[model samples]
Target: MSQHPAVTFRSAAVVLALALGAATPAAADAAPRSRPGDAVRSALDELAGGGEFAGALAAVREPGGRGRDYTAGVGDLATRAKVPVNGQVRIASTTKTFTAAVVLQLAGEGKVELDAPVERYLPRLVRGNGHDGRLITVRQLLQHTSGLPDHSKAIPGTFFDNRHRYFEPRELVDLALTQQPLFPPGKGWSYSNTGYVLLGLLVQKVTGRPIGAEITDRIITPLGLGDTYWPNPGEQRIRGAHPRAYKSRTGEPGGEPVDVSEMDPSRGWAAGQLVSTPRDVNRFLGALLGGRLLKPAMLEQMKRTVPVPGAPRGWGYGLGLTKISLSCGGLAWGHSGDVGGYSTRGGVTEGGRSATVTATEKSLTAEGDKRLDRFLDTALCAGQRPAAGQALR
Candidate 1:
């Protein structure tokens, strides 16, 4: 068997902390629901109590920059520990937004051309499985229209079975090379971690620095996102106080939640390996939307979007960002992430309000995902006043 096989992470978004299924009744919160942000408080309680997750977290920032954090359920099942507000969780494919932002910054600097062929930097590296580096543009990789098959689809065994495996970026690319392309480059839209892996390689090639360092220097440090960091090679433990993440006892969804928090994340390099908190992620989103990360022209280019097949109605994807239509009207842009043992979902409004919802499990039932979406939507629109929603609950 191939060593350090792929692990499942929905590069687009996992179907969230709960899997798609029927909604079960969650317990009601004892806290008064009439106060400011009480809507989000109750939502977290439901997510923890009846959503079948071990814990949940959310951080809300208003248009004027005020922020509030909330948590529910236990951090440690064994100790019955309280969940830390704004605790760090594996932000999964949301890392794509960071990678894409850095690339856009490079594009703005003229160091990389968005329309240039991948061959320009990583020549011959993407050849195979009906794909050619010469024909695929750097844009296609970020946009996920390169027609590459996802290597994570082929990861073998349960998440626990490969907890300590270390994988190189090239190794991840090699795994995808063995599979057939989904279609000719740019002919369609598909989510492939393989494309992001190539993008990561391209970043390193052009910057003469590790992709992680590029992200840190260009994005993380500049924005003061102290809670975010790329894991060093072979590092597995989360660096700060965080709730233990859980996996089903049988290594499948819908069983007892087992502590599955610590594991090597090399398999998720570039595509889904960063650890961060809801507050930090929300800050990043607001700064990005406020045009702090990319020049106006490149930011516009990033927002120029195409339809995402199989996504909810009116959902569109821009470079690495996702544009979701809120029920209260207008758009909220951000990304969602799901790694085994943790799931995060939220978005930021163009007006600068944002919310991030996280769960401490790899599996969130279908109903749970929808509930979280409602919670996010409520937070985005409930009190903002500029749009159909309010500021933030």
Candidate 2:
């Protein structure tokens, strides 16, 4: 299991959540000017202009109560327009944390039970191909221990092939049923998009409302994340002054960039389909870790970590969050995600430091993923002393 940082809450980080306290009016400012985080801005510039991505956006809050929004590269490859500061982008799997938070909140309210069998809520909906709802618990699904096959396999072709197709929640789950299980419930771990879809179903079953609305009422509005929102069903275009997401022609980093920002993200429902900005994402994360979103007991449950096999050393998965070791010191707890045309990575430290990066294209190679991790890690550890040779690029 990943180790939690020794630092606790009630620190400066909680200060951010107190005022809906981030993403200012200057968030639309043009690219970097002479100021703090020059290194962070330079790093983002290289990533976007170096042929790895068409554009990138970031929001970083330091330990001393200072924060800034940054943009790099072009927003639209066709126009060569500037990237919007703190632009909105599809947040992908990070939505898992929102879904998990609602489930945990429901569990806290006695409306749901963490250990209850999936069959208890949805009743046989999760049966087929060695998978059985009777044997899977709510906790298992939230934690990716349900042994369910990922429904992404059911998406037919590449993401571009069905950018406009809408998928029903049950239809996605049934698609996973056509596949085999990864392991018996609670016996192992694997990332399963299908499991979170079941969670969406459970939330609907228990609350009698759509999962998106639950997330909005329970989390977004409370945090005052004005730049964030759940995309309505069949919602294809991003709703604000955001950067255009790009797809690589060869499906690899450095390949020719193609615009693919408009997409119907039904395939990622309950697992990955929310739109948000770096500042909004940072604010939401800080609020979540600050006790505004869940009761203390439930937050603890969200912090419990389990080993993620094949993940980097010191990497672990919690209910819907990620606990990863930082370069400066200690650990950061947040999630990273990818969708059709965007990739985002960020984390809030135990001490209140946080940073988020949104690249307009996904990393198609392991090396590219590492570069993204390195840049975000560099941003979080900014203004701190550097190691012997690990200074920001």
Candidate 3:
């Protein structure tokens, strides 16, 4: 397993202190609730203190198949808007989970074979890289092992100051093609927004429809996920009432903490463009894991990949879904999303109980990611006691 850059125990201690220190008052808030509710509430409070996120909203499905919603903090900072139990926000990479679902649906219909070579559709993408772009498969792209670079640079720096601008999907793909291959197709794992954008294009080609249309026809409408949509820059503004996402410009060279409530969908494009509420995320994930979406055989195939030890969820792929082991005695199948000023983590237990929390903070820094994972862990593992670390794998 590739370890994250080592942090000295002292630094870790400082972070832990910050996390636990924030938890104290939250724990107090939960004192009036039942143990399970208290656990969930405590976790939400700790997550809210991280400067990047404005709020955390969650829904945990019960064994009897009922779901409960929990929310904390203000959704929008300037207006002090409370995050509605049904408030929608940018899903970022959580859109991958939906993307994967559509692909799996196509696979089931025999429209696209997961193992087929990509040369059939995108012949020019890998032409000169000493890599057989033909060797790249849909499955590899979904699994993040396609050896493609994360064409984030495809997004112009100027757009960072004005994230509400739109760019065509072709423009994003062009940026990816300009970069060198990170590795040969199927050789290793690297998170590549580029691969998914291509996958989205393939979905368009194979289905003879836009990716958004197919997702709506196949997944969203059927699931009754009324709050989810594939939005664009024109539709960038946060609707109804929700948290205003903030980005840390703390150490950025002459940058101010930017409010990111109106970020561009083109920045994420197909890789992270979906917008949804916490309740909808929970519903979609829970339905997927509960065998409501994919067939038993296909679901098994999706869960068949290798596990990345010690990561929150051991890595595996089927379509866009990922497998993760919770600190509690459960395995969750879902995806995490990060884009501009939004961060989302959501999953459904193997048995179909689900939990999800979305925050408005997005940062590449170690501290930021750790904080996100901690909040997700708390939401997913709420009632259960922590298990031996072995289960984390």
Candidate 4:
């Protein structure tokens, strides 16, 4: 097997220090046991205290309920600025969920077939290294069972030295083609950014427009996600009031954190390049689960899950979304994203409650990851303590 690094963080923590100089009105006097957002704010406070994060934000909205926002720490460590309450963030691989939603919508419209061979649209682009385009289906691509290697790992120096370089979608796919397949198509499950890149190409082929435009027209604009956007090529910085992002020196333990807020996002392309805020993310997910994005059949198909053995327990891959069993005893649907200088996890419960939590630091230690997971679990569970012996999933 190839040694490609996993795109998501393997683990995360929330330090117990309160980094915000002043508490927000939404968080000041509420008890976590009484309010879900209060619980999330408490968790964020814990994470910011350990010095692992420069800043963090959490936003939650419940059905027929008032929305609440919470924040901890400073936006910039150098300047000691507060993080913007609803600032735009890179949002990394969460873009896949949006991409998959668009593709599934096309399937509903009869513009594309879910099980159709990718060769039908892209022709010979997927040919190479024991990979056959004729055998891989569009469903497999969105489900991440196409056996394709991640281009980020397949190509050396794609992220570090070329952080500012812009790449066409085809070029990114070509890099993955240079590596051997991880497994025959549909034989096993593996996360492949290249597979999603191909799906983006297929979307372009069918729609005659870039994936960004389709996502904007179908998902962003319709859902009223005003703060969400796909950055244009050569656009290297987040556009709104936002916290600075930091990456560990070489993304390893004990390395100095470096600011990486200005890298070009084209390197992530359709797979992971979209930028959004916690509130916007919650709104999108809420609308999705509320049946605003896809037709009934297509939405059900998106939730059809397969076991992800390499991921945390109770975690399953379904189209581009993740089905996670919460510690408080229920299923939550959403995705997690990690890229240079940022890490995010968010989800919506079946009853229409949504929450998103973000950290400014990219490279998280094991403890940090656990804390982040706990925050997600605690927030979604709606202030209900996890059942005894139950842990964050």
Best prediction by lDDT: 4
Candidate 1 residue lDDT tens string, 1-393: 000001112343322111111111111112122355555666667777874688887777776666777777888989998887677888888888899999999999999999999999998898865879999999988887888888876677766787789989998889888888888988988778788888899999999999999999999999999989999998899999798998786745678776878888888899888999887887888899999999999999888888766666556678887777766677788777777777777678777777787778635555545666666776676643444442221
Model 2 agreement with the true structure over 272-357: per-residue lDDT tens digits: 88998888787778878878788899999888988765555566677887777666666778877777677777688888877888
State TM-scores per candidate: 0.89, 0.89, 0.84, 0.90
> Which pairs of residues collide in candidate 3?
75-243, 76-243, 93-337, 100-320, 313-324, 313-325
After superposition, the stretches of candidate 4 with alpha carbons farther than 4 Å from their true spots are 1-37
RMSD (CA, Å), each prediction:
6.2, 6.2, 6.0, 4.8
lDDT of 4 by residue, 185-219 (tens): 88888778788889889999999999999999999
Best by TM-score: 4
Which is the winner by TM-score between candidate 1 and candidate 4? 4
Instruction: Please report, in order, the local distance difference test score of every candidate based on alpha carbons.
Output: 0.74, 0.74, 0.63, 0.76
**Candidate order by decreasing TM-score:** 4, 2, 1, 3
Worst 10 residues of 4 by lDDT: 13-22
lDDT assessment of candidate 4: 0.76
